[model samples]
Target: MDIEIFPYRVLGSDTTEALLNDLESLEDVKRTVIHGPRFPKGEATLPPKYRERRVININGEDVVLQVKTARIFLEITMESTIDEIEEICKEHIPYGFDINQDRSNYIRKQQTVTDRIKYGDKELPDELVGMTDQYSTFDDHVKIIKKDD
Candidate 1:
């Protein structure tokens, strides 16, 4: 099952870091991807802190966060796990957030025509599967994280 987390406000680097770290710690969480508009590139006058791509720690691994978090999509094993996710969100996203469960297509469930064309006979890792769309580049949107021991 998958759940879409929509925050009331666009999250800054610090909040994104904290939220991702917390989410990655859950045992039932299979995979997570943050999707949103890309940060603007040519803002030389702005402070260095405002520039895009901040490093965030997820399950003790440091990942370069390229996009400001507009929505977080999580693939969890059980529906009951949603409560735990909501509890974490309530703490991090104090403003508010909606946990949408209505959409069954939030995450892709199987291989598509694109996958067959991209890698003809090659097998993909489970974590890398169902991550990208038919028209888009996989690595451009998919950020894979290793689980902490």
Candidate 2:
């Protein structure tokens, strides 16, 4: 149901952006979550090449990348999708990576009290659930990227 991709080293913004773009394009990928320490405030003080790219273009939408990619959790439908994901990773994460089908709750798959209180009776789309940062308001975190129909 879910697979975790761990790179040998934390990935930079360009690699993360390329990997995410490829993964999001796959039909079997339902959702993807990036887990790691976020770029600290005043990160711009670092050299341009070492700086965390705050924004990246994915499927034509600009998204702010909050974290340095330590791990990537993906919800996939078919087993074959794992191999496809590996291929995409090979191209982007050239440093090598490991994929595990761990049954851990990497991402919240169900709605919570916060969801009902925040959304009221209107059904929240499956794609939108668990995409927000608990530390920040929904509007501050999620940049709704409209995928092609």
* Clashes by residue pair, model 1: none
Cα RMSD for predicted model 2: 2.1
Give me the displacement of residue 86 in model 2, in angstroms.
0.9
| Per-residue C-alpha lDDT of model 1 across residues 33-98, encoded as one tens digit per residue | 888887777645678877656667877777777778999999887999999999999999999999
Cα deviation of 144, candidate 2, in Å: 3.4
CA error at residue 98 for candidate 2, angstroms: 1.2
Q: Which candidate gets the maximum lDDT versus the true structure?
A: 2
Show the lowest summed lDDT stretch of 10 residues, model 1: 132-141
Candidate 1 ranges with C-alpha deviation above 4 Å = 43-45, 133-141
Error of 1 at 93 (Å): 0.5
- Candidate 2 lDDT, 1-149, residue by residue in tens: 88999999999998889989999999888778888897898888998877895789988888889888899998887999998999999999888999999685566778887777667668888877777545577866666665577
Q: How many clashes show up per model?
A: 0, 0
How well does each candidate superpose onto the true structure, as a TM-score? Answer: 0.87, 0.86
Please estimate how well model 1 matches the true structure, expressed as its whole-model Cα lDDT.
Answer: 0.83
Q: Give the whole-model CA lDDT for all candidates, comma-separated.
A: 0.83, 0.84
